[model samples]
Target chain A: MFKRGTLVVVAFVLAVLLTACGGAPAAPAAPAATDAPVAAEPFKVAVVMPSTETDLAWSQAMIDALRSIQAEMGGEAAMQISISENMFNVTDAAAALRDYASAGNQLVIAHGTQYGTSMFEVARDFPEVSFAWGTATDTGEAEGFTNVFSYNASAEEGGYVNGVIAAMLSTSNVVGIVGPVEAGDAKAYIDGFEQGVLSVKPDSTVNKTYTGSFGDTAAAAEAASTHIAAGADVLTGSAQQVVGAIGVAKERGALWLGTQSSQASLAPDIVVATQLYDWTGVLKDIIAKIQAGTLGGTAYDLTLENGGLKIVFNSAFPGVTPEMQAAVDTAIQGISSGVITVLP
Target chain B: MEQLFTLTTLTGILHSTIRLATPYLFASLGETISQRSGVLNLGVEGQMLMGAFAAFFVVVTTGSLLGGVVAAIFVGALLGLLMALVSVSFRAEQGISGIGMYLLGLGLSSLLFRLTLGSVQSVRGFAELALPGLSSIPVLGPALFKHSLLVYVAFALVPMVAYLLNRTTWGLNIRAVGDNPQAADTLGVPVIAIRYATVTVGGAMAAMGGASLSISAVNIFQENMTGGIGFIAVALVYFGGWRPVGVMLGILLFSLVSALQIWLQLVGIGIPSDLAVMLPYILTIIALALAPRRTGQPAALTRPFNRGMA
Candidate 1:
């Protein structure tokens, strides 16, 4: 009897495991066939992301933009979207890209920089399908690809603006940065932030540390603690991993400036402001170009001047005084009008 | 470099080191018990992820930290039980099954998170409980005494586990099963039962280690948030030479080095941040190499037992 019970338990657990594995990778059931003569054969778009759609960081920004576009174009019926999220492995991501392309996704979006090599390979095979990937400006033109689109966010512009706000509100002349890695957009944001802080308070100290990972929340939290211990009153960082740092900042009552996405929802009280990425304008442009037969070759950038990167201040935190707000607005205008160069 | 020597900086490093090491301590110590019973569970990372999600989910919905911790422990044990059924009862390859478990835990937790809560949310997890008198000591007080309840529980488990593994009759039976299962079986020891218990306990502890992160350390959960900490915990068991105190020391050394590297970057002493970040990992390899070669590996580890076969 005991042996029989054990077998039953094992079978049940295995069934649950199989179901869980089966549930993922099955892209949310394609918006149930609309009976009312679908609006213009739903523009099929597929996206392969490095992390989950709700990471509230890099991946979330793109997903939110796509959702807004879908809403604008009339719902799921007018704009069909398929997402294969958490594709951290390049090989697996390559396979996912191929699968989407073969399945007739007209415009396939590989939403991570690491997917460049695989994307170009897949784009080569499906010349008719338009491919887009970003936080990069490589259109793969030199590499001989035409159906590929590249978009980048001039993150430093908003990073500099956030830095200006941090400098104005910081009581202790010391600021801290919990960086992920010293490369890509993360690097650009940090460099620009340091410059903004120094531009305002030349004597203020900004201690920066990269935890060598984009997902090591524990390490990020420790870095935040280290910063707080060193007398830093204002903190800021980019990437999805900043959630951990934000938690630490909230506990220590340190003001935080965010980048890449709006982290105001994570900790409204302590997250004073966030430099959010609004990719809607860029996505629409890419869609239009693709529809107009301009499959590739042009690289686009999301900048403050183009109204793609926005600085959103949290109302829950009263730290941004009218003067501080004015300083931020001035910095934004300067960057947008080309009067202020964010990076050297 | 001199800035790192200040009392505040030193104490700060020490404080963060304890907080950082708590998860490793729980997971590795639990791994020690499992390996001591001759079952090597490589699915610890998966167990931790499930535990983290469970704890975070419960806390967000119920607003009770205790409820979160309990849910984590329960979910962890259930996964552990599944591992036992696959390895101990079915006699499948332990390593392969463990990996399968890990993938299952990862996918299930992520799917559940999406299906239920849908977005990233934070909850107030464990609050630091400063000891009555010891918390007042200068430098060390704030550094060591003030931490979430889980940190204290994790450290306390080390000695209890040590005593359980060294002094108790049950510990002897576990050691016998790991070292010579056939002999243990002939002598009337319930090998399968002991293996199940140890593996299940290991899963529970690994999960708690994960809970420590979501409910205590960061108080937030993201997919794969453990971020290979579970694998590191498994390595610390080998580094500690399969002993509880040794595992505790290993965890301290690794976490202290990690803490030091973070400090090095904070002080900006001119070393590149990339090189600074590699310090803990590089130091761990060096320490593992330099340590005395005392192979205390369980002979029966990874060997599924059968009554009549050798």
Candidate 2:
């Protein structure tokens, strides 16, 4: 009887083990009707993410947009749409792009700023495969080659919004920013922040620090603490999960803001607002251009005017009076009306 | 204004020193024991990664942290057994076999994560644990007890390991076998069985160290998340003079460097942040070079003990 019970327990353990390891399988097969494979001349589009899609931030937004595009084509596709993620190296980018093209993917999207150099190098080889890069600066020729194009947000406008909030909320007359990397792309936001702050508190001092990494939370937290120690009451950044700054702010009870997404949820008490970049809109434009055949190799400068950047305020910031809200509204109108040109 | 470098910051650094020290301590301790048993387990890093992946995946799936820890230990043990099989029974090259196991573990865990999660970006990490009473202490509380349960486990294992190695009969046998496997075999000790046991236990402990990173510290598993912590553990073995207490000190020193980088940056020490980051690695090399080399490692370490010679 003991031996039988032991056998039964062993079987039960095996079942649990298998279930745990293999619990999450691929999305269930679409209905039989939806499974009918559509046929057409294949136009291959390969999407590459620097990180995985589960990140729920920049990479996730891009993946979500791509998924929506995939869904629009149908449950299944005639055009081979391959999505590659977690490419940390420039080498990984080159390999994936080559793999996509070799696998007959005609259109390749390098969906990370880090992939800019790699994409440009590989694009020279695969001129037939149209390349789109999400970066601030485009080293690739504009409409010269039949392949390369760049799409980036007007972070200047987004930065201006956060600057306006910081100017209004900062009690110390000093604010700080923790940048991911000090580059042209990151500089645009800083310029805009300066412009926005000067628009309100012309004499306000902006102390900026770069963590030299996109997602090193320890560095971000340390940088934020330093900024806070320097009498900066408000801080903001455009880094990946700059929420580490908010985490610091939460620990020290300092005001903070973020760019690229609604991270007000990160520290609801401290976060004034976030400049949400609509990556879906950016992806939609790419798809639309592809569909229209007007997608030329040009630097796509998407702005608030084009629904690329938005300033989202948190309801938790009750201290933000209607006058403060109106100030932000006025700045948005000023940018849209061409009265205020946010520096590029 | 509080001075940039204050007692509070120093205390924070010390606490962080302890928190980061755990994984390295656990891994090196495990490696030390394995080495002491005349076996070189090069698969500690891989075993740790596999353990981390298994633990994290299980927790995410079942929503039970304790179950995840248990699952990680099982996965670690299985990998350890595999390592022992190739290195002990087959008498394979310990280093090469270890490298193979590392590659397999890293590749398998990453593949499994991607296959299971379907290429999402950042997954949420585990919540931090705050000990009810201990966490209330001003500086030490947040620095020590406020860390993950796994971190605490790493420290606890240090004393236990020291006792196991110095005071116990099995420990003496392990030392005897590692020092001279053929001699131990002649004396009627089950040299092979003990080697397997030590190597297996070592793997499991190393895995637990890995679980600390995934389930406590970072909570998110990135590619190559071990970040050469395994190698650091190996170096610690030599630095600690193959002793558990000495190994913990090495772990503490390494952790201190990591914490110091952050603390310096926070206090605006003005050394250029990049340079500050490099200090830990530079310090590691210096510490290794300066450590007393008098204490000899196990004589038969990295060698297969053949009982037939007896």
Candidate 3:
């Protein structure tokens, strides 16, 4: 028994040694994806979004725009959209940047401000791929950082449009905004929406409730219901999954003005129109800059005049008659043509 | 106001209770059995998180609800075996090792989920399963019969667990080991093996509870999505008098409070929605404070057994 145990131990050691020796030679240390060779290849643009594609709201709109832009450009440009949900983890951001950069992507567009720093760092490392961030904050200064830019929407302007529609359509002169949170980035929209609503109907009492979450549909629904019960005739929100809020409005038969995307189809009767952000145009212009070789490393803001932000009213909205539509069209034309300016 | 107590409300309450309790029922039963065998597995929460992540990812990738559930159970059992190895074999502090297991599971599961899923915004969930013959019945149809298969399994496991703990030889060995490990060891019962087996079974059950929530109840997994269900389930061991039947009743009661809160919100009851959302946790706290502590906890719980102690 002792001899057998010793023989078994020896055999195990020999087996391990042979297995180690037969293993393939160590591969060379590969270069980081961002540091890899970048030659004249298909223009690679990466869309780093805030959420997954299944969200069916802001994230989806961006996806649809990129796809439409791709389709329109006859599939000549390669646009890859990577989505992350509530992922503020620096490691995750770095990994995504590394992967995209390694793929020789010359242009990386981060849709949220949270990803800005990591994207910029990755861009600095590569120094070849250009990085653009959609942000509500200013990018401090321009330097050897020739590849980082920040962009923002005219969200306050969008709020103004929603306010106009709500004031015109409301029966009770009581409007409400179900905001996600009451601080920071959302505060601008809240103040702007209030200004917009009060501008159109000075007597309109705009009630506001913060659902404290951006993705809790149940919470959003409950908050919307509370507003409706409190005598708000028109409802709006800056919340993602604002569709749930729309559902509440539809259930109560109240008018709702849209937020990020054209939510008119969610409830045609309730959703009069959305303060639409044409992300498609934004993406196309970005791609155009890349093609024109004029792509700056600084963030770009496209607004109503630049065809990036505007309100789109559905044909079926009750208060939007031919006259109302023509007036809105005239306003849009004036804004676009620099005949009128809506300031934030 | 009076309509809140009507038939629709009561039925809704019951329905909601079942949904909320399903995860708890499975987890508490596992804990009960583990405790009954002189093992206190504190890794229930971590096991649950892993199960939730596993089931969510599987369901999303395969588009197979059933596949997700099976995978969750399998992964859960594998985790259970790991817990058993450290606590039973090495004779380490079961609590510490269990906690270590939990941390490992939690970190690993979250890492894997982010790597694969790419942190997408939302995941599509499984639809409710309405029973053919039973679902058509009034009142009970939506409340009891029309729930996910996991919910049914949760309830069914109650009686099954009760019977196993009371009537069987294996149950007898478990109780013997838990009550007097040295005495059981003298009688040729492998006390260590029995304790490990019971604890492992408990871990798997907890995993199932977690999976039920991810794959059946919500059908999507989010960060920290178990939302303290595992801790609540662990607390439920005290709530249920550390017995299968008692655990089921406790789970059902807690779930009832949850459902009541939901119903109140649906009807626009004059209450703060956040307060209503907090009702279940409040009830759990109350239950914990009100329980007769001495009678509920097992005599040998969290204490490792040694044959020489006899």
Candidate 4:
């Protein structure tokens, strides 16, 4: 009996090891159909994202932009695309970057800021391959890497806009910010949001809490609950983890202001508006530069003026009165035209 | 700070503490049972992830909360059975095998989720089952009585588990096997069977703990959504000295500290948020260090038992 049990155990371990070795097949997005004849050699692009492409936040925004660009360029035949999702580990992301470059992808976009170092390291080896990454603006020119490109979104612009609407709709005069960490785009969005709230309703209380994690949904939910408990009728936060907070807001009937992407779909009744990051403008520019043989050494910023950042309010939620809409529109125009700076 | 003492704030913190501690309670209680039976499943986190995914997947597909829970239990037990085969039968190093199980669970669940659902989706999970009369009793009622059914099950398991471990004959046999497998073997106790049973039960409970999060507390599943709760549950077993009630107290303490920090930040306290977040871990370490000498640890833990050996 012991011998049989040992044999079974050995077989199970071997099966698990084999499965691990034979990694899961990559699921590429279905190629869009077009009547145009296929190009002999298409302009291939590969993207590596930290979370799944459908996270409805950071990663989703980029994938949506890629698909949009593909459609505009006459579909998959004109612009071939490949994606590696859930590449949260820097080592794995670096490996994916190198693999895509070796496979002759013309433009490789590493979609998370955490991949900046790894992207640069991989960019050095493939001089002919154009690489892009962001929520940052360093193009690695100082580090002397010409094949690398960087982009950043003026997230504070939309964050400020969302804040204005949230403050306008808030009945409690207490708004809450559920932040992921006190760094990167999350910090910028939170800071801009607070400023926007204070600018609109100077006496309103703005409470902020950082869960110190990018993906701890449980913590985010608790933080949201705490916010609601403290008389916050309106809440706003950034990062993919806000899905948890959104669920809480929906349950408690508190209005949620989103950033990074349009999260109204998560809770149509509660998510009043979102600051969406539209990367097509940035992607188009990068593609244009690569096609023109300007491989890298330039940084791009997604601003409201460039139509890369947008504040999309949910029409399902009737909380956005005409007065509130006008206020939000004014804030958007002020931030975009350089008349009112988002950050002092 | 003085404003933080309001009835509303205190009730909110208490409510949050209970909700947050549910997963820990489930994971640590299960870990306690497994540890008492001579196995240390470090892969509880992985099992929890698998459980979370399975429950969420089932609920989204079939809209049956019961089916989701059963799926979690089934997947968790399978993983636990795999652990038993590796550690108990193959005589592999328990620590390494447990880590392997953890990685496998994490990877497999993520893969399955991508293949099936392909995105983050939410479901209407278990609703708060407010105990009719009890739920109306001002502060305590709202804080303790108005929770999902899973919360009650998790807390109810405490005394049940304590009784099973201390009063029942099967519990005595399990204790004997974990304490001295060879001696128990000589005494005609089924040492291997007891270990297998305890470990499998541990896996089911751990998965249920995960289900509590996805289907009860958060009502959504994200990749690595359980975060580090599983590993913390393992440490909590040590903190509780392998007792169910002790484990409950430890989970509550950790969760209470976490809730307090959230409240402190919400009240606009001037302390750095980073330091506030660290409060729970710091307090947990201090409590563990000040805990009574580790006297309840099973003697034959992590040791694969074989007859006619040693």
Candidate 5:
């Protein structure tokens, strides 16, 4: 209770509170002419996702990419990451996005299309803060915001490849596409798949159904069943709830191709290939740009040539033939060279 | 588009109907029991979620599908006890309490899944068990006799629930307490005890519906996986006029129209995809408008009974 003891105690309490608040790490003083000192601040990225990180679809894809990036770039101490997941409600998501920027995060990724308005609004308030979002190609340039970056994938390139293989393997000459909604990447993938099937066999009919929701497993399963009953020998879909469709396919002994993330583990034998959305390189580039003072204004498109739109063949699939592999490779090359335009 | 009524297509539609109706059947049947006892447990969705998570976790940890189902039932019963405590014993506002229960179930299930499972993973779900001899009988066999054990349980509960709510002495007391609790109290029927029993049964059955979804239908568990289907089940309770047979009819109509809508889209039938997607909901609303005013609803539904006040 002495006066000197009280001064030390108060100073200790304030330091603990500040650290607990996660205030920006105090920049170490310019070493005072010390040797072997690193001057870089930790690169922190905060993400607000619409679904759980374990969704194995859109949200999971980003999370997996972040974790891999974290490990590759010298782990958590060097690169800090925080996530607010299951933000399906826009109001909560907006609050979280604002909170992250205010907390002094170096980069914030609002990982959903529905978040565009909130993200832009929040981005406007913090011009110096870096923000990213999408399944979109716009960087908010028309709005004159340089701190917002967009990323979209050419999922059709992989979907087209899947359709080619599906048609070749199908005896019924029918492929089914189960989609969550008929917009954005879902539409692009399905459209590409239809054309890919027709490219191999002009008579091949690709039936597509949109379940109206990304998380409706029951609906997805029902759609898969209807497609199978209608004589589809192969099926493919993108989104989180395609797990249900894949389950039905595995049961009926039908082949399945997946996208958004690898679904091979869900059904090893039946899953032929997955359009792996490898955003790792893109994410790394974004981080590097943020580190280099280019907060935003650049949008990244994942295409075949960039090593982002990869067709990951499941080793467990027995349906693959040497001829089918050759055809898929040719389609990839044609797509990369711009010789083939996938039209649905 | 023109030749829509082939035997093969009809059978396929019928099969789809049965598959889609399982969750609805379980949920509505469970809700019916609670309403029959004068407790409007609008927490069926929450109960279903708790059940789904419990079932999923148990199955993953122990590798026992049966254990997963029972765990769901156990969780449901515990939650029902919570509901009974809040509404029956405490006599809180039934509507608000029911909603609170719903939110609690929703939040806890999601939190638990993230904590325990860490990520979405799949377990070996219940396989379809085609009944011997019966599964071979032309179109009907493949459509009706080929389903998982959970499907049979859901369908079987219809008759069992009918008999329980109508025939037994306990059923008589439930109806009595639900209609006029003061009168039942005068007649020496334990009103509070019967309410707890009925709510617990309702919760367990609802949880079973959720388990059926994860373990049998979808074969994987995801957050918000029930996707408001529990709310639909509650609607079915009113649509079915609170009768087991009537509820069954409502479920069949819902699943049939749902399947037919998807089929229409596939066949390139001229209906706009947006309108077609809304077929089941539109049909449900239409049926409700055309139906009777009071479809055997209990006289004291959602009313908490206090002995001293009465």
Candidate 6:
């Protein structure tokens, strides 16, 4: 019995070693996708998202942008948009990303920062597949790849706008921040918002709380309630969990400033303004580049000046007076022209 | 500390604590009965998710909280019945069966949410029922008296659940089947039937917990809404040692720490918010470590019963 067991174990070890040796060899310089320039027959685009498409935060914003892109360029029949959403597991996400590229998708978009590693690795395998990913700035330029396009948003531009409006709308001289995790975009939005508030109303207190999760609605709601209890008449938050906060703002009648997407559909009575990220311009440009055979080298940055960041005030919210509109316009102009720096 | 422990802060903490505890309490109480009857249902989390989705769907379509909760209870009961068929009648491995149930709940809820809502829309939630004269009383009055109707039901269930499990003849049969199924069968107690009934009831309770979360507390449905709170409910049974009051106390300890962390973040306490989040989990680990050497789980728990000649 002992001899048989030892034989089986040794055989297993040998098999593993042989399998490892037979895997893909290291390639020094892979061929670029631009060499072939695959013709776009109907513009097949596939995207992978970290959460549900209806989360109303990061994933929802991108899905809405993709939908709008399809509508503008023609209908879904013409654009052929395919999405794999609620992929919280990175491993599953990587597999889906590979499948889409291998199945002849014209342009594949991996829509989460966590997917960066898997996306770059997969992009190497299919040199003809144009890949885009972000909330990051690295376009694989340093990696010597010409088929990878990167996209990131200048959320602070909207964050600054949200802040100026929050500071103006806060009746209690106190504004609260219910932040998702301290990621780059969320942090930029929060910091720029604080700067905008202090610049306008220095005396107002801005308390910030990170729920340490991206999708836990109850935790977000708990943070929001605590802020309301602490005398914050005005609140601002970012991410999908902001839905929880939106529920609270609606219940308590507290003014809410939104970011990333247009949240006016939710809590119409309380939502004052939202810095909606309109990626139509960026999406159109990426498609245009693909048609022109540029595949990837350019990294698109969605900012206020380039008509990517749109500040949409909720028409249903009662506090949108003419004076408030003028102040917001001035802030927008100042930020666009480099007169008002919103780096934080 | 003195400055932070004001009346308003205490009230706020209490308010959030009750809402947070509602789902946990409903789930644990239901689990307590199932475990007491010697059946382990690991699919409580899945059941909770199903219940949450069912309630949210009904309420969104019909605009009635009563209809939503009723649908959740029905869904929960059906799931409980299914669990009995998988684990009891078919005599499949309980652990694997429970896991199958979990995956079903997780996947189905997400698919249903996408197919139905397709977007995040706020639905109506239950109103806070403040006891007029009592709510005017100092500290405890405002904190305890002001809560939604579901919160009151969750608290009231404790004593009622305790009574149902302790004093009734039906309870005796359940305990008998759990402790010694052969003896129960010989005594004409209908062991299989008792186990099936207990597990089904447990399922209903777990689903109500989900209903409390989506319909009464959060008023919005998203994928995996219960998020692992159902797994925590399972842990709670072990922590509570299969008793109603004990389970309630375990939930309170966890929620109190959670409430404290939220309040501290607002008061500008210097502790990192992540560390604050870890406090309750750390406390649960400590509680389990300090628990008695022998937990009072039923003898036949997780074991499928056979009639004779084993």
Winning candidate number (DockQ): 1
The better-scoring model by TM-score among 3 and 6 is: 6
Looking at every candidate separately, what fraction of the true A–B Cα contacts under 8 Å does it contain?
0.81, 0.08, 0.03, 0.69, 0.55, 0.53
Question: What is the descending TM-score order?
Answer: 5, 1, 4, 6, 2, 3
Tell me the lDDT of model 1 at A31. 51
Least lDDT summed over 10 consecutive residues: which range in candidate 1 chain B? B287-296
Task: List ranges where model 3 is wrong by over 4 Å.
Answer: A1-344, B1-10, B56-65, B115-127, B132-137
* Candidates 1 and 6 compared by TM-score, better number: 1
Model 1 chain A: weakest 10-residue lDDT segment is A30-39
Clash list (residue pairs), candidate 3: A33-A102, A52-B120, A52-B121, A85-B119, A148-A297, A149-A298, A149-A299, A150-A299
Q: What TM-score would every model get versus the actual structure?
A: 0.93, 0.77, 0.59, 0.91, 0.93, 0.91
Q: Per-residue alpha-carbon lDDT of model 5 for A1-344, expressed as tens digits?
A: 69999999999999999887755445333234334325555578999997877776788889999999989877887788999988889999999999999877888999988899999999999997999998888999988999988999898998899889889999999888898877888889988988889999999878888888878877888899999988898999878879888888887889998888888887898999888888898899998897667899999989888988899899988778899989989999999999998753
| Every candidate's chain B TM-score | 0.98, 0.93, 0.92, 0.98, 0.97, 0.96
Candidate 1 stretches with Cα past 4 Å from truth are: A1-39
Instruction: Show what share of the native A-B interface contacts model 5 retains.
Output: 0.55
Q: Write one digit per residue (lDDT tens) for candidate 2, span B1-310.
A: 2544565665667666776687788789999899999898988889988988887787778767787788788888889999999999999999999999889887898789888854322224445588999889887777777665677778888899999999999999999988998888889889989989998898888888777766665555554567567777888888888899988887788778777675565455577756776787899889878875845689888888676764
Query: What DockQ does candidate 5 score?
Result: 0.61
Over the stretch B1-310, how does candidate 1's per-residue lDDT look in tens digits? Answer: 8999999998899998999899999899999999999999999999999999999999999998999999999999999999999999999999899899999989998889889988877888898899989999999998999998999999999999999999999999999999999999999999999999999999999999999999999888888889888888988898999999999999999999999999899989889889999998898888888878657889999999887677
CAPRI-wise, candidate 3 is incorrect
The digit string of per-residue lDDT tens for model 6 on A1-344 reads 99999999999999998877765352223434454433324578999988877776788788888888888767755688889987878999999999999876878999888899999999999888899998888889898889989888899988988888888888888899998777778889999998889878999888888887778887787788788877899999888888888887787788899988877887788889898878777878898897777789888888889988889988898888887798889999999999999985
Per-residue lDDT over B1-310 for candidate 6, one digit per residue giving the tens place of the 0 to 100 score: 5636888888888878877888999989988888777788999989999999999899999999999999999999999999888888888888888889888988888788878887787788787899889988888887888888999999998998888888899878888888888888999999888889988998998999988878877777778777788988899888988889988998988888888887777677888877777787899999998997444788888889989933
Report the C-alpha displacement of residue B268, candidate 5, in angstroms: 2.5
Better of 1 and 5 by lDDT: 1
- Cα interface RMSD of each candidate: 1.0, 5.5, 7.5, 1.1, 1.5, 1.4
Worst 10 residues of 4 chain B by lDDT: B114-123
Q: How would the docking of model 1 be graded?
A: medium
Quick one: ranking by DockQ, best first? 1, 5, 4, 6, 2, 3
Q: How well is candidate 1 docked (DockQ)?
A: 0.62
Candidate 6: lDDT of A300? 87
Clashing pairs in 5: none
DockQ of each: 0.62, 0.10, 0.07, 0.58, 0.61, 0.47
